[model samples]
Each structure stands twice: as C-alpha cells, then as structure tokens.
Target: MTPHNELRLLPWSGPDGKPCFLSTDDTGGPLSRLADTTETAQLNVGQEILGHAMDVLADEEVETEELRLLARDLATALRDTLRVAVSRGHRLPALDPSTPIEANEGLRLSAAAFG
Candidate 1:
C-alpha cells in the first residue's frame, strides 16, 4: 500500500464537496501544475484580502454591513488558505519511521498540549 503522505490532497474539492486527491509520481504533470497554479492564485488572493481587511479595521467609520461582508470574504480566504496549507503539508517528504521517537520531541509536545 502507498503511504498516506504520498497521496496528495488536491487543492480543490470533488463530488459533493468531498476532498480530491492525486496519486501520481509525476510532480510536473499537467494536473500537478494546474493545482500549483491554483494554490498560488488562492494564496495571492488571501494576501490581498488580509491587507484590505486591515485597512477596513483601521477605519473607525466602518458600518456594520460592510464589516459583515468583509467577515464573509475573510472566511472564504481562510478556507482557501487552509486547503492550500493542507495540500502542501501532505506533499512534504515523509519522516523516517525507523527514527527514534525522541527526534519528534516537538511533535510529541504539541500532541500532548492539544490532546
């Protein structure tokens, strides 16, 4: 069986809003390139939205409705950013399973803090 990390989590959704995946060794393939481009665009848009949000927050006269709209847009950008992060994270090289657990001290600490 292929390792879970080897199966890429695509940047887009599949049927019924389910997450899509790619399981190919070709990193330079058409689909991979497309996903890369899309992730880039999404991140750029997210950056723009964050800048705009900061500007909006600095305005004391900002209305409730405008703030509400900004909130929705921010939510959308956050969703896209998270998707990109998840996809990229899965694509990273897997850690050696034979390595000692002490090598993952930070990971263990994080898990303990969260769990």
Candidate 2:
C-alpha cells in the first residue's frame, strides 16, 4: 500500500490470477464490515468507483471517457459526506438511524442520549 495524498494504492488478485491495483483512502471509515476481515480496508464510495477506474486504466479492460467523470463523482461524494459529518455532528449514535430511539423518560435518558 502506497499512500498518496488522500489516495492509497491497493493491490489484489485479478480474476485471471494476476495482481491488480486500486486507489483508496486509508483514513476513511469502512464501507462494510466484511472488508475488515481482509488486508484491504473497507472501501468508501469514492474508492469503490476509483477502483473501477484503476481497472480500466490498467488496460486489462475497456477505456472510456466516462471513467474520468466517475472518478470526479466519487471524489465529490466523499467530500460531501465528510462535510455533512463535520457540520452536523460527530457522535456516532446520532448519525445512525438504527440506534435505539428512547423517550425522554427521565434525566438518565437525556444524559445517555446526548453523550
């Protein structure tokens, strides 16, 4: 893995049993829990699209102008996600909609909810 600015180089076995490369971010949160079990970090949205771009650029696949546009779109998605996280709040429980929704039964609930 080679870290380049916000992108990190990732290597993996291709379908043909050869090594392939992808660009990723080491700092981003996991895209899924499954990836945590591998040497690869869970890919964020930007990294997922960028990986496709890497495949195309590697010349083992078709080349198209659309890939450049896709990379840009992924970059924007990552930037927006981070911006929203920063602007709205940082606590994890608040961000997750599945977290228990408790009523203001008493001061304890309020304290736990805010914390």
Candidate 3:
C-alpha cells in the first residue's frame, strides 16, 4: 500500500459528498483519470451555473421565488468551486513567506483571501 502522504487527494467529492483520496503513483492510472474526468464535469457545471445566474439577473420579470432559488444554486456552485480549488491547492508543497509570488501563485492568492 502507498503511504498516506504519497496518495493524491482528489479535489471533488464522492457519491456521498465526502472527500476521496487515491493511492495511485501513476498520473495516468484509472483513479487519476477518473478524477480528471470528474473535475472537468464539475467545472462545466460551475460554468453552466454562472450562465443560469446571468439569465436570472437579466430577467426583468423574475419572481421572488425564482430569485431565492437562484441564490441557493449560486451558493452551491460557489461551495463546489471552493472545494475544487482547495483540493488542487493542497497538492502543492508548503510555501514560505520569502518564496517568490509567482511560485505557488494559487496557494498564495487563496491563502491571503481565504485564510
């Protein structure tokens, strides 16, 4: 079995909405491929959510119930986007304050805003 530290933690949730970790050393392995596929699907869904939100905002006759439903959907999409970002960010090694900003830019940006 691969050591816990060596396994890759996937960015998306499982069927039960729980985090999933993979033990494969090969990036092209089945689990890794599945993760890649799932991540793509998530991003696509997030984009679709944004488009739907735009439609809601553009509608002049949108009802209060429709607005509430749109807000809930946006919240869910935001949560999923944050989860994926954190998952991908966790894969990076810890960075020191002295490290160049360009190196590990995602971690630096997110840590500053979200930490």
Candidate 4:
C-alpha cells in the first residue's frame, strides 16, 4: 500500500493536459487498470503521430496547412509523452547517491543522441 503522502502515478493526463495522480492505496484496483489501459492507448497514438509526421515530411509538395497540422499533432504527442514519463519517474525509487555513476551512463548517452 502507498503512504498517504505518496500519490499513485496515473498513466494519463487530465482534460486540461495536466498530469493526473491518484491518492488511492489500491494500486492494482480496477481504476488503476483502466488508467493503465488508457495510457497504453495514448502512447500508441503518439507512435502513430510520429509515423504520420514522417509520411508528411516525405511528401514532395506538402502544403503550409498540412505542415501546421503536423506541428500541432506533434505538440500534442510530445505533451502526452512528457506527462507519461513524469508520472513513471515519480513512481520510481530515488537513485542511491553511492551507486556507481556508470549505472546512469546509458540514460545520458540516449539523451545526447536525441539532443
């Protein structure tokens, strides 16, 4: 069970595009499962947006409106992805200060690759 101060990480954002945290002890309850399912769907949509953007970019004569629409879609996907990532990060235990620095080298490398 989670402590009162520790809110459960939800997998989805609220209607206003804010991260949603649950203050429930039942982490494995029906509502939690539903949130998990919804999160999966949102992630899938993000993936699809990436694919669609790729297709749009590959076109020889993309219109300005098309590019604008793609940009909006990408923004939405990025927001959702960030929310999901933050929620998951909150659920993880803090890294020990004495742990080997090499443990997080992969994350740094990945971030650099994206950067």
Model 1, span 1-115: residue lDDT tens: 3434377778788889998989887877999888888888888998899999999999999999999999999999999889887877665546778988787544523331111
- Point out where model 3 deviates above 4 Å: 1-7, 11-17, 93-115
lDDT of 4 by residue, 1-102 (tens): 546467766766589967677877665789877876766777899999999999999998999999999999999888777767776566655666787878
What are the lDDT scores of the predictions, listed in order?
0.79, 0.43, 0.73, 0.74
**Which wins on lDDT, candidate 1 or candidate 2?**
1
Model 4 is weakest, by summed lDDT over 10 consecutive residues, at 106-115
- Among the numbered candidates, top TM-score falls to 1
Model 2, 1-115: lDDT tens per residue?
4433332212234589653333344434453122232322323554676676676677755546666676677776665444433322322223344544463222233342221
TM-score of each: 0.77, 0.28, 0.67, 0.73
Q: Write the per-residue lDDT of candidate 3 for residues 1-115, one digit (tens) a residue.
A: 3333655668666899887787755767887778767666777888998999998899999999999988998887788777767766665556888878886576534452322
For each of the candidates, give the backbone clash count.
Answer: 0, 0, 0, 0
Question: Model 4, 66: alpha-carbon shift in Å?
Answer: 1.0
Model 2 lowest lDDT segment of ten: 31-40
